[model samples]
Target: MSESAQQIGEKSQVILHFDLKLNDGSAVDSTRVNNKPAKMVMGDGSLTPNFEKCLLGLSVGDKKAFSINANDAFGMPNPDNIYHVDRTKFASDAELKEGMIMGFAQPDGSEVPGIIRSVAGHSVTVDFNHPLAGQDVIFDVEIIDVK
Candidate 1:
């Protein structure tokens, strides 16, 4: 890296490789899996403000590992995110099972993934909360470039 290499800041375009891991050191995701680094512009809403703060002032070729608390990471699960729907709403051919993730259509035509929490006689409980909610995480990153 050059001494004058750009540092990551507001609106700066950055390219980097990163690994997302749980507090237990279990890997959740990583750019290294396919050897394709991620590219993003700072403050573009692709990252949470706290997550972006971790990248501030980092320069090319810099490597960092940071841990974020549960609330600051994916956030704590919300009770409102859990909903009970009629079993008939599901496809007749669908085999509903605990821990199954299914996509539900939204009013805007987009899809949101919901995890089946429980299946009863006539109702199914689905949790729309993020899978990693309430979990602390570690982010390991290597800055490839910042411009």
Candidate 2:
């Protein structure tokens, strides 16, 4: 589709490529490398308000770069999200290694991924932070489509 002058707004379905990077130019996440452009509905809350606001006045095919603070991007990590789990909860046949991520089921049957921070004796420290939390990031985007 040819580029349109439409301003992104609520209910607009946007298809775009994004690169999330650290201030040091280290990439954190990118849809370009993954070769799968992302699709987001403007008002769905999938993209943080600050992130979405950057696209508000953009038109299709527009490329833009912006920075968002840690709190505005993925809020700071909360200590309460960290948990100490009994080693027994791990599958006996599975490897338990620090920095490894594992899926845990909550009482509500939802699965939450936890990253292992340490394993000592029968306790394993798992952090449930979003990973990019507490760090400022730069976002580069190429708007592919807006409908």
Best lDDT goes to which candidate? Answer: 1
Once fitted onto the true fold, the runs of candidate 2 whose alpha carbons sit more than 4 angstroms away are 1-5
TM-score against native, each model: 0.94, 0.91
lDDT of 1 by residue, 10-83 (tens): 88899999999998899999999999999999988888898899999899889999999999999999999999
- lDDT of residue 109 for candidate 2: 100
> What TM-score, to 2 decimals, does candidate 2 have?
0.91
Cα lDDT tens digits, model 2, 19-107, are: 99999999988998869999999989888889999998788878999999999999899999999989898888878899998888989
Tell me how far the alpha carbon of residue 29 in candidate 1 is from the true structure, in angstroms, after superposition.
Answer: 1.2
* Every candidate's lDDT: 0.93, 0.89
